[model samples]
Target: MKSRYILAALLATATVMPVASFAQQSAPAPAAANPASQIPAADKQAIQNFNLTDDVFNRIVKVSQEAKAQGIKPKDAKTDFSKIHSLDDLAKQVTDSDPRIAPLIKKYGFTPREFLLANLAVTNAAIASEAKGNPRMAAYVDQSKVNQKNVAFYEAHKGQINALMNEEPDPAAK
Candidate 1:
């Protein structure tokens, strides 16, 4: 029962964290009227390389939308995602604490860390590109630098991360 609460809280945190961070920064410009053209080529390639399938990415967007509708806030205002060194840190903490999370993440073909890292990379790239024309969005450009570093870290350790995820018992095996 306690674990369920923890999982809920973590999921909630995951949903709201980015929104809260963006809120602290300036409001983003309206997205390009054409959605398909919005993602830059480099960002698209990064998403593909990370294997963040449409289903996985859509689910993440859905969670963010829900969080916004509910006006959720971060559990801790001081939590700075820029400081996260690697996806491994996120994956281990979440999966180790709640076995249930591992399977859900696996369903999306991601470790928890991979999911977060990929999403952050894609999001930051889009925001940074948009910020390029707007002086007010300078902070997003800085945030994007942090995200790019983390994504590079993930790419460097991709094989090891996949091996670690594979070591976990498949949910179906149970």
Candidate 2:
């Protein structure tokens, strides 16, 4: 039960925190220097295969709400949030902003990195689900790349996910 709240917070923060930075972080110098490294290959596949489950998703939402209620806000990050390029980098940004988040998420069985991935997976699945029913939206999503499991989960919990995603942050919680 406590873990569920932590998980929810992790998911919410993971989605909101990383998104801006995910797009802007610099490319790995190591990858550039070692183009053939298995590390990069493994990281790529890990991101592609990060799985999401109902328990994990519930925890993320719970964590997010709990964090908000506690007023456990993240500080300003070091990097331009707009420039974060990878999940690792985004996790770093999130942790750096709020050291407390590490322990918070740990209670829910997530490393910050795992939270970010789960958050992204949920967001992607939501988008893909929406695209499935609307031809105009479907035109934008690549069906082959969408994870069927995630979509199925989203379909099953559309109302809850949408409510969480559309919720406005409480001003007093800031």
lDDT of each: 0.43, 0.60
Clash pairs of candidate 1?
none
List, residue by residue over 87-174, the lDDT tens digit for candidate 1.
4544455555545556655654666766565555444434444465688765434543334544444455446433432332223432
Clashes of each: 0, 20
Compute the lDDT for candidate 2. 0.60
For residues 65-167, write the lDDT of model 2, one tens digit per residue.
7676666654422344354545676677676666677777788888888877787677667667777678876765656566778778878888987676555
RMSD of 2: 7.4
RMSD per model, one decimal: 14.6, 7.4
Model 2 lowest lDDT segment of ten: 16-25
